[model samples]
Target chain A: MKLEDQRTTVYKVDPDHPETESLPTLRTEELLLNMGPQHPSTHGVLKVILELEGERLVKSTPVMGFLHRGVEKLAEGGTYHQFIPHTDRLDYVCAMYNNFAYCRAIEKLMDITVPDRAEYLRTIVAEVQRIIGHLFWLGTQALDIGAMTVFFYTFRDREILLDWFDELCGARLTTSWYRIGGVEKDFTPSLFEKLKKFLEYFPPKIDEYVIFLEKNRIWLARTRGVAVISAEDALSFGLSGPTLRGSGVDYDLRKYEPYSAYPRCEFSVPVGKNGDTYDRYWIRVEEIRESLKIVTQCLEQIEPGPILADVPSVTLPPKDRVFTNLESMIQQFKLFSQGFEAPAGEIYCGTEAHKGELGFYIVSTGGGNPYRLKIRAPSFIHMGAFDFMSRGYMIADAITLFGSYDIVMGECDR
Target chain B: MHAIAEKIQEKFPAGFLNAQEWRGDLAITVKREALHDVCTYLRRDPDMDCDYFVHVSSVDWPDDEERFEVVYEVYSIRKRHRIRIKTRVPEHDCIVDSMTDLWYGADFMEREVFDMMGIRFRNHPDLRRILMPDDYTEGYPLRKDFPVQGKGWRDSFDFLQDPN
Candidate 1:
């Protein structure tokens, strides 16, 4: 007989976020279940340890670090520049932001900077990556909420953006495109022109999403007030990005602590009144529009100039110079051999990444390699709001709430 | 100076909040002793409520007199202001007073501090290993001295990855 009619049957426990509550009601007659560290919905080695009271979740504890390679501690052992590639692992959905945050931190420590042209390009690509990331969230969140067709529509644009990323960097997901001083190379004008075309057509695609899901009676019914977090609770748990903004907390690192020429660009940070699954969903939709604004602004401001800085002490010598001049070759050899040494100081630089506030804190001991590197991943803290918010709601609410938080396991595990 | 943060720099000292106008960007330093007071004042004072705890994480300062430094980044939802507060702690003993009392939302965060940094929370209710096995033995990995794979590089606990 199916377990739905049989109260005697039991199920396996979800290993990633299993229920964390002790239900005395279930003490006598309940069956517990395991979900997955390897399932379609579990998405990568994420396991949820769940306790159930007859198909209803009694408690949930997220099991993390299943894929932990100790990226933080490993960063301490590697040279400062060597660690940029390491950050690529975190938030695999938007590795550009990950590399950008790490490199931005090093750039701040060195007190060196990118040329205006590079900064403008960085802004443009960052927003493009942002659009791609939100598309992933929209697709996956919709899939989890039972809107399967929307996933296909959402990924259609996402696939196009991913190809753009591939065109710039050899890798699609883990592109260490952003270097400490500036970008790796001057993007071909063709890339920018293509991106301009994307920016022009993307807003109407977002409108399609809004019409498909935003005002849909069924979508709103599942998301509205499903799991509400007060602005206070959201902040206390170290919320950032859309989750914090969704709770009516108008804090965005781009606006508050602008890096990479964010200040020069004019864009709005969309906010939501109630911190719920629905609001989080809407905020991302709104943020995509704002990212489109940024892409447009970047297209207009971009100029023809050197992408990398003249500081050969930190930046690599141009290939042309390396092949022609001994001085340039020696500078290249020195930069590659010893790496760049920053002044003795510690600093934290945060970027309003797609997941949330992806921050990199660097401790420079006046050496070529960093003394220590710590990443302030937003998913770990955003997950903190999960248990508090999921209480009293049905088991299905956890799915919507998880999607609303817009978690990426790589960031959480790291 | 930016429109919003420029006004703040005018009222406070150049060194206050560990921020000074350097090429039109902001950076500030606050000692551990005054860390609590600075945050309380920021939360209470109308001028600077940077009140939302956007993040709380520590940086390993190996050569300095203080080896570990924890930063408190607060944002005022009402004012849209952001302020970063840093508190340094010596390596020999890492302890930072709990802020959960002021913000109940910090209960888990304090516990997370205890878990990741092994910084003793003076009044936290439950302080145990989080994001790691309960029986695992090692110093704080986030600390500069602690090895990335741990000191022994041996698994002391089998609670996780156990087949039985």
Candidate 2:
């Protein structure tokens, strides 16, 4: 066929008729867009199916379980003591807090009172971990919003604490420094001096990070008034930590429940009013300052005493005692091999992690191994409200929404 | 008995089975049919005010007549108290009313409980496998019978074979 013959007349535009009865109607439908199981802005392997009417998101269905390691099932097979290391992988970004939370849960189950000094130590280390978590979140969230310099500035400050963690424990990321009843060891003089130095060096650095993003037009435009959820919805959806506080709900477990040394510390829980991404970011930044205050208070108030609880049946003996004393060695061997008998009952302990409330629900049947273990991961819970929050926002703002929750897929999927 | 337990028992005397306060946590067990009404009462009652949905978890007991126990733990922000509502479900009829309508967060938590323990939730809007894949055929992982080592899906993979 000739070129002219191939080009058939489709719809003719009539000059006289302004309504254009001759024009063909266009078929428009909502476009389905898959955000990621591998996308970088997702922070980890999390996929969300977004239905878009043009650029604005109509609805989003988050497809999780890409990183399901069945951590709860593994907990049933192992003793209570064996599960501390596994908690490290839950929110892999902040492992010390996971260790602390898990140890607190086990202590609650065993009904063991942590020593005064050990409680102070746990509080200090946990506050330091909170600072690390906030720093990580600030850096990553800023990077997700296209602010790269803040990432470098925040991470540089984060490295000093990570190194301090390395000196406190052996490893940095998976530092299982918390025992069931108490901490593994006491802080040395050098470690104390390093923390004192960090406390001094950290406050101005937090100010430096705020200056980088607090005034940036791009950061403000991307985060302000984006993915807002009301205080009622946040509570109804069971959001905690900065995510819930950003919605103007002062429902922090640290403040309300008062576990560990949080009751002893004088730090305030920063709550936001707007319930937007910017408010969430502001709350996190303010929390970093409060965490610093907590660590400083802990340092001053901390006294020298036993790091581990003196329960021979439940707690582990000191490393020095295990080597010298035969009775201590036998106690260590028994506790490691067969965990202390947890009473036949169930307990749910919720700890306020940086992300949100990381709760563990354990049912024990008078044995070392738990009958059933349930982890109420906040990331997974926050994802439940994603469709509600991200309804009218642009497609690009999806990353901002994920960052606002400070979600980690390891915990979410598990 | 705690005041909350007494209140629940006063409201639904026939539905209430047992109420125990252990480890400073109040747990109340209700008849399976009355689970929804009890939760609705807890959510709507001004005194209870249990607005925050904490978690939905289930425990399995193979030896018991009621093989499964569904657990729902909710907290009240205003009152600053928590309650654990539990109901037993036999293996043959393993179903309970969903609280997703009451608490939006219960959508994922109930889905998780359904996925891991194979306990179905009636009136759940979008009930599907959450942690596991959509096509997962093996039994519930949290059940006492499900082995710690998975159900041979890993062994069936062809990549592990020796290439001679």
Model 2 alpha-carbon miss at residue A357, Å: 0.9
Give the residue spans of candidate 1 off by over 4 A: A1-35, A50-59, A214-217, B1-48, B59-68, B77-93, B104-109, B149-164
Give each prediction's DockQ, rounded to 2 decimals: 0.27, 0.54
The local lDDT score (0 to 100) that residue B122 gets in candidate 1 is 69
- List, residue by residue over A293-313, the lDDT tens digit for candidate 2: 998998999888999999888
What's the CA error at residue A363 for candidate 1, in Å?
2.3
Question: What are the per-residue Cα lDDT tens digits for candidate 1 across B22-79?
Answer: 3233445666655565566666777775657656667766789987777666667677
- Count of clashes, each model: 35, 0
Off by over 4 Å in 2: A1-24, B160-164
Instruction: Name the Cα RMSD for model 1.
Output: 7.5
For model 2, residues B79-124, the per-residue Cα lDDT tens digits are 9999999999999999999898899999988999889999999999
